[model samples]
Target: MKNLVFALFLLPTATVGSAGLAFGEDSRQLATLPPPAQEALREEMRDNLVALNEVLSLMVAGKVKEAGEVAEAKLGVSAMGKHRSKPMDARPGPHMPPAMHGIGMDGHKAASEFAAVAKTGDRDKALALLPNLTSACVACHFSYRIR
Candidate 1:
């Protein structure tokens, strides 16, 4: 199962350019705002990511209901909030750093999807989806400055 999870981590890169944008760009843009605003967004995103990790860990351990609850509490809500924050054209300024949008969405999507799978108690399907979730992490790391 661990090996399966690791393999799932590799899936995003295989499908990278298929998605239009780079990873973390949206969050990176958000990060460039005034420190207070940026920190708020960062804290929110960090919390969501932590929840996602916990949910995934639970899923891997076959703790389906608990994982689903965490996903509902964290990733699902966070993704909806993050996704709602701007119009598509709200690009970063010249002074702003490079960013990766795909990863942020991928992580959110993965958590949501994992939650869905956990609700069904299908560990195999949940494990199968792990790669897509991991892809987001890898894509963001590869494309962003992350300051």
Candidate 2:
């Protein structure tokens, strides 16, 4: 199951580039945003990637509670509050298509769920939840892009 989970996580990365090439000229829908919102969204995405790495590293180091803390702080629904201070038009959520926004919300929820489970120090259960946390990212990236 661990191997299966690892493979599932890698599958998207393994296929993304080839899928794009084979399909010709990225067919993903373009999400138009105000320049400020776009920049903010991109920065948030970069931070998310960093957080993802940190969570994985912490998990591997057997610091499950630390990993959970990072997940809640960085990827959970609470992280969404950062955009509240931005102008409505300058917030990514307001600009995103409903489906795209739903995926994004689902990803955050997944992270929150993973964090809760991780805090219990159940390594197997936490590992099982990995795909739920990551598949939303894979789906959203495959389906939409900023332009």
Candidate 3:
């Protein structure tokens, strides 16, 4: 089951432009924000990537609880235990388009579900959720451009 899930997870890259997936432009133009705001967005995304790495390591080490905790605390859509993306409306200067915000929120929602499933120690279910969570990332990346 794990192998199957893992295989499906890699299917998009192997499928040569799968129609169900979104393909993003190589370069995306973001709104003109002050240097600080740009930095903040970069930092937020960086932290998210870091947390993802941490969770993956923990899960691989048979630390599903820790992985779930990290996901709930750091990866959830509204997670704010530490660095977090500011609300779109609250951000200074121009913000992401509404569609971008929606996709981001969807990613968060997927993360939240993944964390919840992980907490149950149901490896199969947790593994199943992984693809869904990651698909949100793929979809968002396909649909958005950040410059």
Candidate 4:
């Protein structure tokens, strides 16, 4: 059952990859945002990757609480508030497709939930939630492209 669940999650990503290869062009839908907004979004995504790395490092170091703090500060719902304060031209949410926006929101929520679990200082508990947090990102990336 676990293998099946993993395979199901990978199926969309695999399909998208193969389709892109077959078409000799990107097959994902374009997520149309202004250049500034695009830059902002890209930067935010980079930060998210850094934050995830930090969380994993902390977890490996037996600092589950610190990992939770990092997750909350960088990827959770609080990060959404920071996003709102971006310069007008850099606000990506209003410009994104509804589906894309929804996926992003879900990812943030998942991050928040993961942070909450991590706060319990149970690394196993937090690890169990990581896939839920990351799947939102996988779903969106396979479904849309910024360019």
Q: Which of the numbered candidates is closest to the native, going by highest TM-score?
A: 4
lDDT of each: 0.57, 0.82, 0.66, 0.82
Q: What TM-score number comes out for model 1?
A: 0.55
Report the poorest 10 consecutive residues by lDDT, candidate 3.
80-89
Clashing pairs in 3: none
lDDT of 1 at 6: 55
The number of the candidate with the highest lDDT is 2
Q: What is the lDDT of residue 39 in candidate 2?
A: 88
Deviation in Å, model 1, residue 142 alpha carbon: 2.6
Clashing pairs in 1: 8-131, 22-101, 23-100, 23-101, 24-100, 24-101, 25-99, 25-100, 25-101
Please tell me which model should have the higher TM-score, number 2 or number 3: 2
Backbone clashes in model 2: 0
How many residue pairs clash per model? 9, 0, 0, 0
- For candidate 2, lDDT tens digit of each residue in 1-147? 233345456766767657747655767799998999998898999999999999999999999888888998999877877888989877888899998898888788889999999989888888888667677777788678997
Ranking by TM-score: 4, 2, 3, 1
Candidate 3 lDDT by residue in tens digits, 1-147? 233334456756656665445365343335555556567767777887898888888888888877888888888855732323555443532466765666666667778888998988777777777755565556555545555
Q: What lDDT is reached at residue 114 by model 2?
A: 92
Task: State which candidate, 1 or 3, has the greater lDDT.
Answer: 3
Q: How accurate is candidate 4 locally (lDDT)?
A: 0.82
Misplaced by over 4 Å in model 2 are 1-23
Instruction: In angstroms, give how far residue 79 of model 4 lies from its true place.
Output: 0.6
